[model samples]
Target: MFLRPEDAGTVTSPTLIEAAPNEQPVLSGGVTLTGWRKDGSNRLGLPAAAQGQVWVADVPMVGGRALAFRQLWVNGRKAVRARTPNDDNLPRLLTWDVDKQEAWITATAVGTLRQAGQLEMVLHQMWAVNVLRVKTLTVQGAKVRVTFHEPESKVQFEHPWPRPIINGKNGSSAFYLTNAVELLDQPGEWHYDGQRGQVLYWPRPGETMSSAHVVAPVLETLVQVSGSLDQPVAYVQFKGLTFAYTTWLRPSEQGHVPLQAGMYLLDGYSLQQPGTPDKAGLENQAWIGRPPAGVELAGVHHTRFERCQFLHMASAALDYQSSTHNDAVVGCTFRDVAGNGIQLGKFSDEGTETHLPYNPKDEREICTNELLENNLLTDCANEDWGCVGIAAGFVRNTTIRHNEVSQVPYTGISVGWGWTKTANCMRDNRVTANYIHHYAQHTYDVAGIYTLSAQPGTTITENRVEEIGQAPYVHDPDHWFYLYLDEGSAGITVQDNWCPAEKFLANANGPGNVWKNNGPMVANAIKQAAGLEPAYRDLLAEQIKKPAANGAQVKQ
Candidate 1:
């Protein structure tokens, strides 16, 4: 996701140096660009001299990771397709038309879009391209000028250049492409002091005595800032807004079971597509409700919880650890969870199960930098019965993608920590393409993507397991089997997955475990428990290309 072949500039006349070559036009990069113009208009970048439509309403929606388009010119050479709106089809919006260079694109074809009118270009090829929408945004004084209204669409804007702040606080602001639409239409008092470059406010909704300040919920205005420079907003979208109470109450001594997320903004919506269900997950339930015993919990960051649905929560419907980061709990759905639906570490009972074997001075640990992608868990545990769908330990570099665990009961995807000793506890974690199934058996452990006593580059890839047993014979399976390694853990890589094996099980050692190139019912017990022989089992049976199917699907 990096494109920069000579900063191509020029909407009708933006600039990067041009006077020759047919009124000076150069955008050659790979092409498939568009802004909007079939009578909609949006090719923004103004301030060199500013003009018209308030120069596209003073262009100001910027956030990054790639969603750039600048001088794209390609008219009759053909080869620039774009048409995808959801289902992860990928492609938000794009258009270009600088004096008849003619471009027309939508997004999500993957590659190919290089025209020849203004000289368009765009060769992404695949992967990485989240969401990039633009209504109108410009800042010539700080450079960010683009404007186009259909004539033809191509795209341009290359190399590290996407920074336009103005989210919310007092002096209201909203309009971001890379990310700007979490629910903030108005409210005031937000300043960045880099010489008046970032400011937001509205301050008149409820008047409020104005001293302690903090009122979030904007998408049609409701902001109230004070002064306290804070930054952590990559993407947030919550509509049907509701932000309440915020937390601060203490009275728990004899038997503590209290935790707080200290809500500032909960139940937010942001252009959520794919069969709409966001309103904090269908009909508002956004909460922060309990906090008293010492009060100090703040949650929700890098927000996005589509199709949100919850019930009876004890905690962790989506609790971002302390100083949150990179959060994304897409297509959410949880039910009757007394606790544990999506907890990326921290919010302790030391680690549930009523303090499990974990009892470190009452425990109140921390681990953030969250991400629980594509979620959906069901019937979580009740009455503090200990349930875990996605639980990390002292979290680090978290990423749990394409999720879909089922009828929860205990352990479906648990990583790191049996207690807190801490030392790079959970490093570079990634539990990808998940779809764990029916968990219920506990009484000790119910494994399926479970790792404990943490350590060693954890990565459990390409997951898919079936109805993990609950009875009949007490099945219970999944690697590391029962790791402890004196509570330090190590380099775990259980690759190319597909589960459902019940018979031979007995590797509770937990010392430097490795089961490389995994696939095919644990591939001969990971070569006889890492003793390795029989020519490494024909080199792990020639890397077992893909023959372990049983069940897994969320794809809705």
Candidate 2:
């Protein structure tokens, strides 16, 4: 059963007060309560909510309509906001007091550094940084006293980049501080002291603290519909609802390292490799582990997500995993996500490896006949730079069309699984009529459209891709392409695609792939080959009058 907001009645409850330490308020499902009061104080002091605890609201089904909450408003406004840690270029490094376990940072005033916080160092990799907590801090006239929880080790190596390397070992480097009141010197910088229950902020230029609204995401997952293979959830629909503010916490067992799309997994690596071409090191996978999503549907069938908004999420917005079929996500918007916008199917080899000579009749479980159409995905992969806008692995009979994906740090759309031409049930997928651009901005060896392994009946056609591999921070050979057919990818057709990039296609030893009329003149060639010059011309004329109609419909 599902419920929309209109089907439920609003209860006139008093403002929810924050619980004392070790106490939490339990919210039942099937009811909706606004999170804020008229006085601007949060009815729910989620900032003080304990970790790993979620305040859930259940929506009851009444007369076939499911009761739902409209939104989670905070400080009199929608609480979906940017979470990038504020940073500025490192100031001149002064002397390091080794015995004191502190480094003297040049500053104008002690201002906010008097509080405890964290220091970050990004020596080489973009997504992987070394972080150390601040134990104590002091401020002088023009220099600040900063002490780390641990002592810093220094090593030296050579790199081509001009940025200064601090505590670099074997060509690796790092340098910066964050999450401290003293370091909240730049606009948009914020820090919270859990011990004292205080939140500190430095507003952006032309902004004042009194007018700024501060919010911290308290939920890890907004919605999850999980069914087993024997009892799949069916006939569910989510329309015109805005889902936001899921949080992701870095694991304590390991250092904070993000794989593709800001997915923090137990074992992950960056796309950038160490050493020069002549002395190459081991190549790493974009992501080696999986993370959760904001809206996850597993073993679900015959469902629809239409005209929905998924934003400000710490993980993938829409993840349709194992055993999902006959589903559609149409006319939706996914932006400011820390992970992939839409992900279909789990990666092959995620579990125990099934050896070769695999039985074809062994009850293969895959998401099939899924449709992703007419959506806009942008500014995704904000935390995980290696994730794509739309990604699928071990999927079959899927259609990805008419979507506009831009400003992503990695591939726009990626399909298939397995590193080799092994038959893993990924077949008959179609990627067509999409506009993908402004990608590969952070990670490398990506494209507007990327495929892997052998998928015989797959086709890539009639897509427009531009301004790819133009990131100012990316300066490697990996930053090049429109279409990438990687490792053992074969039996695919690439035709009639309009790409004005430096390279039209990249094949990684893939065979049996057909490339025909894929370039800047592909539109004309498509018309000439199909003998529809007049119809094509008329379509172009119609497109010119309303360019927005060429892609997903922009919601009013």
Alpha-carbon lDDT, every model: 0.34, 0.55
Model 2: worst 10 consecutive residues (lDDT sum)? 543-552
Please, what are the lDDT tens digits per residue for candidate 2 over residues 252-297? Answer: 1132443333333233222365532222342433223566677788
Per-residue lDDT of model 1, residues 1-556, tens digit only: 1112122222343212212432312111122222211212222221121112110011123253222221111221111111211122222123333354322333222122111112112111110010122223333332233332221112212111111112212111111111111111223212111122222222333432222222211111011111111433323433221111111111111111111111111121222342222112222111122212101123324444443443223334444445445555555455544345665554334213211223234222334456676556665543222446666655667778666666665556777653222343356777776766676443123455666544557677666655654321111123222211222355666665656443112133245556544444545433222211232223212321111121111111
**What's the CA RMSD for each of the models?**
26.1, 12.7
Candidate of highest TM-score: 2
Give the worst 10-residue stretch by lDDT in candidate 1.
245-254
Q: Model 2 Cα RMSD, Å?
A: 12.7
lDDT, residue 478, candidate 2: 50
Q: Model 2, which residues run further than 4 Å from truth?
A: 1-117, 120-177, 205-213, 251-287, 348-350, 353-364, 475-478, 505-507, 524-556
Position 474, candidate 2: lDDT:
39
